[model samples]
Target: MRNGLSVDVEDWFQVGAFERTIDRADWPALESRVEANCDAVLQIFADAGVTGTFFTLGWVAERFPALIKRIVAAGHELASHGYDHKRVFTLTAEEFAADLEKSRAILEDLGGVPVRGYRAPSFSIDARTPWAHPILAEQGYAYSSSVAPVVHDHYGWPQSPRTAWRPLSDSDLVEWPVATAHVAGRTLAAGGGGFMRLLPYRFTRWAIARMNEEGHPAILYFHPWEIDPGQPRVADAPLKSKIRHYSGLAAMAGKLKKLLDEFDWTRADALVPAQQERARPWRAAA
Candidate 1:
């Protein structure tokens, strides 16, 4: 079972946790650490002899074209994390389409790779944004890893399937959602940034192992900023947001290493193809 490994490439100041405290216009003044952090991430996978997808921000790609080239050169899939970190639900349909085209064009030109995959910033595509996946398919996105099956306060569509499925009836574009596993009849997020950081590593490993043994590839994701402990902290942010963003920064690298060593991991592009037999039709609305 070759599971999916992904990196949501964005700088520390750009994450949603700091949305209220950090202004997007002030982004240029922030000490940008994404390029160096991404290099570290690439090295981790290189040392482990693994390949995965990098769902890169267009903001990052436009500034660091060389970094985009490095990602492509390293044999990783270069996918979109949107033009900025705007959540799908927040954007009107037209805004969403424009953002999509702008991001795909920038990424493909810089990376020299067809940017076929997308992971919405903050995983914000839910029932509210019923048109999200269909628009992605229309824009030439072969797939999206945007849906997280577990419902949380921020974003989710829990009724969706656990396996890769075509959300639009007419298109082949698949929604390869973040993985989850059932525990006592409840769905728990098997893997992703916050869960991987906040939960005990043993639980994540157990969840992934259980999911894999049950014949599903566990799709795990993280961000470049997650590993940077020295990142500038948002001092005035709410305590919960501060804790969620900063508490586990120092330990994320080691956990990623363990995942690489213990589990069979592959790029989403490679993993999605094999999931077709398991793919079913998923409704955009409940």
Candidate 2:
């Protein structure tokens, strides 16, 4: 029951409030940062002998074909992350569908791979928009890692099943929620955003290992910005954003390397084989 890893490919400035400030016109400079950041991650994976899924924003794929090509060439799974980083709940079905198609087509063209998986920006899929699951299935996405089952001010579906499950909303879209730490009847999120940054590495390893024991492989995800301490700071960023994005940046790479060394990890798509039975119902859901 090896765990899985996924990286959401985006620049540091394009996150949260900065999204409002950093216009599409500013993307060229952002692309340079994206390259250096992703290069470091590629090196990290190479050193650890680990492979991971990279859910890239369509904006990045369209602008950086070479980067997308390099990711696929390196034997990692390529997946869509919507056209821009727009929240799914914020978009109408038509808008969401268009974005999904746009992102999928761009990724397929650039990566030269069957981009079967997707992850909502900011992990924003929740009960507020169950429509997203079916839309993803309709768009031919085979799996999703967008549900974070813990409560958060921004995005979380606390009552959502922690283990991978086929939502009634979509048979073809297997919902892979982020890893969590179950303690004394409470489920604590283990990885992603601030949780990955602030939490100790041992705790994450133990939580993920415990999840594997329960027959659910952990899915750990992060962004390139999380490892870049020198990233430009957003002015008047929300207190929560400060904590979630910048808390432990300097330590992230080392912690990530330790995690790679200690755990049995592989790309999310690799788990598709072992999770075939679990995901089979999803195929019908589509």
Candidate 3:
């Protein structure tokens, strides 16, 4: 799509799926791994001259301050991906607020940029937790990319707006849910996450193109772990988790290069104002 791309900057071992087997405390060496992986991502973006948002976990920013600074220096948007990988839906409103505030502070302090956007851990802000939106606004976030309008093993808001739309929670806060494609009666893969790794490259490109054709911006997201297949295995996870995270790791970089070549993408913040105005009926014809 001509819209934009947003990357979640965190390593694979940091994900919640590995929590049961490997607690965050157990993974000390993951720090160096994340730093190396993030640099690889920076090289990719640099080669393409692409400026995209990097929603970083507070933990990542805290340890890798130089990386966060490099992202801002490269003219990319810096948004929070929560303090840890804790799901917003699982936290009480106050707890969730704390996580968001902490993450915002950490990112801003490190990047010297105002962190106004958030993407929930695991894309967990679904219908059951509609309250999360209003809470996000109340906590001073300007936009959220936490919901995906597709069903998955962890999180999906099937009925949420597929395109960018202002939330009733507060006029300033917008909802830019993950892009989705219709297959039969179901919402199929649109952009990033496991779908980016699992689906064929052509399918992902087609889904994004369809969104642009419909006059919407596709928000593509990916994790650092998706590109690192050599990462230590989390054998404790159910068979499905293993397949989801590791299935196509080797091909991710090539697929991403093709994506950069095919789509006209940029950071979400750079496109936010126009996207917000475009959502207005009065501007639709313009």
Ranking by TM-score: 1, 3, 2
* Candidate 3: tens digits of C-alpha lDDT, residues 43-110: 89899979899999998888889999999999999998998888877888788888888889999999
Candidate 3 lDDT (Cα, whole model)?
Answer: 0.80
Candidate-wise lDDT, in order: 0.89, 0.82, 0.80
TM-score of each: 0.97, 0.91, 0.93
Q: Which stretches of candidate 2 lie over 4 Å from their true place?
A: 20-32, 279-286
lDDT of 1 by residue, 74-145 (tens): 999999999999999999999999999999899999988898899999889888998888799888788898
Backbone Cα, N, C clashes tallied per candidate: 0, 6, 0
Q: lDDT at 263 for candidate 3?
A: 88
How many pairs of residues collide in model 3? 0
- lDDT by residue for model 2 (1-286), tens: 6789889998887776465556767767653577779989999999899999999999888877899999999999999888889988898888889999999999998888899989999888887786788888777777888888887777888877777777754354588887998899988989655677898777887888888788788899988878889887766776666676788999999889888888888999888655645753332212
Candidate 1: worst-modelled 10 consecutive residues by lDDT:
277-286
As a whole number from 0 to 100, the lDDT of residue 114 in candidate 1 is: 90
